[model samples]
Target: MKKLYIDYDLFLRPAEKDQPHCSYVLRPGNDGPACLREEISFLFACRRCEDYPCVNSCPNGALKREAGLIKRSGFLCISCKTCSIACPFGIILPELLPYLAGRCDRCIGRLKSGEVPLCVSSCKNGAFRYVEEDDLKGCPDIYPMGDSIIVKVFNWLGSYGIKK
Candidate 1:
């Protein structure tokens, strides 16, 4: 069975000897088509709103608040996408299957064994990291997109007297 995993590492800058050496990055993984997309991020997207709109939007009661986090009941879910639509930040994706609603368990067995999660240890470039949520303070929630061919053409045209 395929499992969804987080990458937990995002390199914002290249390594430089004179710059301050910073470590730690966490983001959603995009290993395969089945894996979570790099564009989505639970840590950065989920605001944990006071109203819990996602949970309340579940008509079948598939989502519930447990221990301050939203938990999804796969069996009860009909994949109606109500939760996703209700989420103001667009964190809960509508494409999510019923079973993937409340996916990450943080690898309980690994933690009990005094080891990091499989994704963290499996990273080849030493990019994966684990850090307290507090470290993410001030990090921007929105990320810029890389320019595409269409955007480049538009920019070039806009530089001239080309209108529309």
Candidate 2:
């Protein structure tokens, strides 16, 4: 049984995100840019804003800044998505927010039945897959987020072959 991994390089393009996939169980939705960009999202680390706009925007106070990084309380999150918009960096995406507590079975029933996980099967862009654990060796864009999840983020501006 291979672990599941997700590889996508389309976060910087919001217009293309208008596709039909709307389930977190399928992919880590558009949370903005990854690494190697001026105005992109961050998964390896947070920006650590001085006056965290995202924290203040949370009506439920589910978000708080600790150790310079913003952390969310899974129990307190109401799924309002207000924080997402409030995020000055736009890294607070829906997929990063849990619908409920921070607990996901990862579609155990589906995997047990010898089928790929929901995300791997329904991913229209073909970003998800099952692979041996050793395959986790990632590239500059590839980030190995534990729990059998792999993230391959794209440097949006670099995609254009633009010179900095």
Candidate 3:
């Protein structure tokens, strides 16, 4: 199946052509679609804080550190946004959290018929694309977020000054 990939580098840049937008009108007070589009928080580098605020912030122990990465428990996550606020670097985007993030659907009916999603069509900079799994090979900046969603991480200012 085709998957959704977003150029987060382009996504963060100011749009010179037009204001970045998605035609998919999410319901009022419902930002599920917005979260679905930006669900790339896992790719964010986990700051080895002396005390992991995000992990401790979870009331249900839904987050933990494993192999230096912050692993989230989908079954335990309640989409409480507490962790998002607790993140010191603001890396944890609440919108992309599982159980809390709304489904993007990939414009399901149309996608199955060989058409792109409304959000993909709306991005003038070509930041979003629905591509085959094989199309992602050799792209170092692109990482798969889930079974059908990928994200591009490039030119990120956050990692600019840290020395390895």
Candidate 4:
């Protein structure tokens, strides 16, 4: 079974400095840009819903279900942004990226070796941890930028695209 965890230690903004000093399931990140981004993203993660509109919307079959998780095939993708459009929460974030860019495989290689994922292991601050998926119920999947932001932004920016 897959589990999700929250890193509470990274929440404090540098100015706040004083760590709340407790294990919290949900808290806003402090003023740091990286922490703030992670907090915002963590505030909105994958829903893993029964009806995956993102998968259904993929015309190239780039996205699929395997072992209770959504897997993406970058090679098969055409980067059409249909799956991004189909996702009600906009969590896919594939608009300006190449096809299959938004997929997260849950670090299968590390899990298979009975080790923690790189993201978790490399987290020197010890803020990373796993939690029950039920805790994140009802998270909105769509992004606020709308369906075509990926392509639209890339076109306007001209080669300096956004990074994940």
Candidate 5:
């Protein structure tokens, strides 16, 4: 099975606050961004085990595990509840919803904007990136050489009419 690796310690650094803390799963062709099914599944499993208090503590029914995804309905989120207080996973930043609908939406927005998301953009070091599952089999473990490699490569190619 393919695995997504994240440097949790890197995310904690004050310098990376603008960046998304986790790497996105890359998708193939037009299939779309890497489906986050695996990551969502992991979170759901953790919730089931009650390893974290989030599942039980969510005041709003906004948080739930379904279809191997840690799904959240923003419309249903009252903003009165303190879901983050119970989980503290930081996965769901209720505060940023006006600008970011959710974690995955933030990532997709970055890709659409022709810019890497804050996390990928803010890394002074090339520490974060999205890699397709199949590509991971042969890729090196280290972060890709420089920050914003994806953005740079895509932009450069776009000059030649090559759309990513």
Candidate 6:
């Protein structure tokens, strides 16, 4: 399976309002035509950082840090805009607003095209890679946070008896 890799900086740019919203549809071999498995959700600002101050600064408990991922609880997000102000890397900005709905998207489409996400591809250091989660185990030093936020979010939701 292919995975999406994100370019954090590109995600911060404002979307042109006139741009058409494209959907990512998938067609399984058994399934008859293409079915809309999911939509291309808004790209969000990056949350990865060695010193993640924004995670703690969010008052609504919306920000979360994980290995290789920073997941936000959009349903719990009050959008008070505290996280945006607290990020030190300038990864979060006022114009890089969050989409009110949808799952955390890590730029899966770009990876399938033999390219990294825009931000990572543009990086001078070649910092990010879109690899299988299992493949990351051997390279622990890379993506040091490794999907911790994803697990945490699921656990948090489970604590409240939420199925998802």
Over the stretch 94-134, how does candidate 1's per-residue lDDT look in tens digits? Answer: 65544433333445566667766554555444433444444
- Full-model lDDT for every candidate: 0.45, 0.56, 0.65, 0.44, 0.40, 0.40
Top-TM-score structure, candidate number? 2
What TM-score does candidate 4 get on C-alpha atoms?
A: 0.36
Tens digits of per-residue lDDT, candidate 3, 50-99, equal: 68899999999998887555777767889888999999877787655757
Q: How accurate locally is residue 35 in candidate 5, as Cα lDDT from 0 to 100?
A: 20
TM of each candidate vs. truth: 0.41, 0.59, 0.58, 0.36, 0.41, 0.39
Clashing residue pairs found in predicted model 6: 4-107, 4-108, 7-119, 66-149, 67-145, 67-146, 67-147, 67-148, 68-145, 68-146
Candidate 6 lDDT, 1-164, residue by residue in tens: 33333222232232543211222224122211000111111112242456777778888787676554455675787767787788775555543344443332343575457654443343343223344556445442222222421110112223445332
For model 2, the stretches where C-alpha displacement exceeds 4 angstroms are 11-42, 66-69, 94-103, 136-138, 154-164
In candidate 3, stretches whose alpha carbon ends up further than 4 angstroms from where it belongs are: 14-33, 43-50, 58-85, 93-101, 154-164
Stretch of 10 with least lDDT, candidate 4: 148-157
| Candidate structures ordered by TM-score, highest first | 2, 3, 5, 1, 6, 4
The per-candidate count of clashes, in order, stands at 2, 1, 0, 16, 3, 10
Ordered from best to worst lDDT, the candidate numbers read: 3, 2, 1, 4, 5, 6
> Against the true structure, whose lDDT is highest?
3
Off by over 4 Å in 4: 1-44, 99-164
Clashes of 6: 10
Q: Which digits, one per residue and each the tens of the lDDT, describe model 2 over residues 3-108?
A: 7665554433334543323223433542212112211243343456678888899999898776555667867989898988987766776656655443344557
- Residue-level lDDT tens digits of model 5 in 1-164: 22223343343343534444433444212111112222322332123323445556667676676653355665666665475566554544444323223333335555666665545454554544444545554543233222322211113223445332
